[model samples]
Target: MKLPASGEGDVSPAVHHLVKGSAGGVTALFAHATGFHGRVWEPTARRLPGIDGHALDLRGHGDTVMPEGYDYPWAAFGDDILAAVDGLGRSGAGTGSGPVVGIGHSCGGAALVLAEAARPGTFAGLWLFEPAAFPPPAPGEVQHNPLVEPTKRRRPAFPDRSEALRNYTSKSPMDAFDPEVLAAYVEHGFTDEGDHVRLKCRPLDESQVYVSSLVANVYDAMAEVRCPVLLVQGAETPSGRFGKLTSQFPDARLEAHPDLSHFGPLTHPERIAASIRVWLEGLGTRI
Candidate 1:
């Protein structure tokens, strides 16, 4: 498999990205969750055929640096995705054949939906894996969970990058991944901080992310989407949990895998990829 030379630089709301594949028509851009980097999609990307693949590090995650005072709003993450798409489109990487497919996981899934809604026809289709779009809080209710707080707080900072990597890999949902694949995640998911290197994701940023989810309304923008959408959800997920929002889309299909968890792409990339391939084929896209 050919891999594009990875490069780093600033790109507005988002900081950097590790790009792969040729600058050809009809590309698929991937977005990952808060604690994860774009490399999480490497396994799936390797299995996909034909289309160019680009994995992006969303704001405040992976190698990307969030803009100052960004507040880590979910909408800002949507803007960053648009910036990446524009960057690729302007570079002639996404022009020509078909609209780019935006594939996202967890919170990334919400951002992708937001991006598509924000700009109809901007994406050919959307493939989302268990996006964490829970229902909005009841009226006059306020969440106080630490995971939903938006205050800056210190977290464990390792003395070495390897230690941080070890800590992350040992506890991740993708712990069973091949060593080489796990190592790739470590390389792109951390930063050296002299006495200690720490995972690139900050706790406060993660908290803000959860809080943002509670307030953002992905369903509100569903009608704006003008393309096919495939939502792959975990069967264990309660039917009404994700804002009961699936019914909002005019052209959407839902596939639930009973045995899969939220980490379907990482834990079952081949299955997910095959499902996606079949779905795309049904859409009349030559694969």
Candidate 2:
């Protein structure tokens, strides 16, 4: 299951990840969204008890630290996905596994798609939740990601974990999450910086990810995906409704849950997991 890096001598940092699910089951890789650590997938991973899950804290978002001068290009995330999937094989997580599937949210989901695009047959299937990609720019249209300013405006350092918890619990998106999930975000989402707690994922770094939306034309890559792709979207995803997403992939299904949001995987892991479980069953022995 070793996948080659896309560029010559362009080495990516080894990803930091955690595994879940039963030992003898399908191998699944989970990627998190912007401003979140990999542990955020714990709830959903647990729901997929039949899946052997691996969760990655992509680059700057979690415990994995990038070397100095690392350029957070959109393509680099694709490389990281390939490297992480390759790592699962080295750890025997992907070896002799029933199925190797990728499950991701937003940026994470898009990365999985890019990884599959880079190396066909690398994954058995894909489950993506409102991954951030749009049709290619119209000729010379400039990059116009709306989240950059909002990310820049985010508070960089929290006084303490309790304060962080309170802030998120009282905040907009986080307010919509489960208490346990919110606690998880506060626990692993930040680090101690002197007397204060700084965000594990820097604000500018996350903004860079959002602003680099066009790093690759995922819409163009969608047509080349040979594996089954299940596009998951919440009832009210801020990314809007991508109704045409199913037509882009060769073998794709769309699931728009009525009560979910962009970060629904965090708040409704069991629900999302159940959806995945049903999808796997429908796939029969392939999963």
Candidate 3:
């Protein structure tokens, strides 16, 4: 899939994406988590037999040029995803199968919710894996995100691609992920600088996404997504309980994977794919 600077009524930086599978198959639009690009979704996408997958590299993250001011909040991200979905539908593929499915992990999943909210009937179904959305805050309560400061201080450059890959593959949360997924992350997550490769998404920019978490009405937005929804979360991850959100929709099911954590989608792509495949099949068997 090509990157369009703007579509579906909004001007923002173009979103980069990759496509796979036959055009005749049902279209599956996927969004990645924070700090990663679209290719991270490949391992999972490849496993779905009859679904054409379009995985996107969101703003400031991949080939998509990051706009100035680091102000592309969650609302902006949702518009970007919505435009991409329209771009795919305009391609004249998978019309017989109904609206495409929306798949997202972490912040990506939250963006999908905003997209479906902004544009009704954008998807036939949704598959969200531990999306980073929170319920209504308590009375006079404050929310302090732990990830912002750490992410801001994160190292932004590596001596070499090998070192970057090694550092990532040898780490904890990332270390547990599939080798192929990690490779894809490193490949699309950085660009070459003069003497080394710097991260495409600078630490500040990545943290900005985390910092802007509460700028939108996340809890209220859940009602806008009324399509068949499958909510998947790691049993052990905090903020994974979304029973309240799921209950708001007419057709929604929640699943908890006892053995996984927040990064379940990346760590266990095959297992996650199997679960999603079953849901997609229930939506409509691919030709």
Best by lDDT: 3
TM-score of each: 0.82, 0.89, 0.91
Candidate 1, 8-115: lDDT as tens digits: 233443323334444444578888876677877777777777667777777778767664444666776777778777776556554346558888888888888888
Kindly list the per-residue Cα lDDT of model 3 for residues 177-280, writing each as its tens digit. 89989988888788999999999888888888888986666667888787888888787545545776677657788888888888888899999999998888
Q: What's the CA RMSD for each of the models?
A: 4.7, 3.2, 2.6
Error of 3 at 64 (Å): 1.4
Q: In candidate 1, residue 228 scores what lDDT?
A: 85
Candidate 1's C-alpha runs over 4 A off are 1-25, 67-69, 137-146, 149-155, 172-181, 285-287
Query: On a 0 to 100 scale, what is the lDDT of residue 235 in model 1?
Result: 62
Model 3, C-alpha of 104: deviation from truth (Å): 0.4
Q: How do these models rank on TM-score, best leading?
A: 3, 2, 1
| Candidate 2 lDDT tens digits, 95-184 | 345668888998888888888998999888898988877865678887677888989889989889999888888879889887767887
State in Å the error of residue 62, model 1.
Answer: 2.0
Per model, how many backbone clashes are there? 0, 0, 0
Q: What's the residue-level lDDT of 215 in candidate 2?
A: 69
Off by over 4 Å in 2: 1-24, 67-70, 138-143, 236-241
lDDT of 2 at 275: 83
How many Å off is the CA of 78 in candidate 3?
0.7
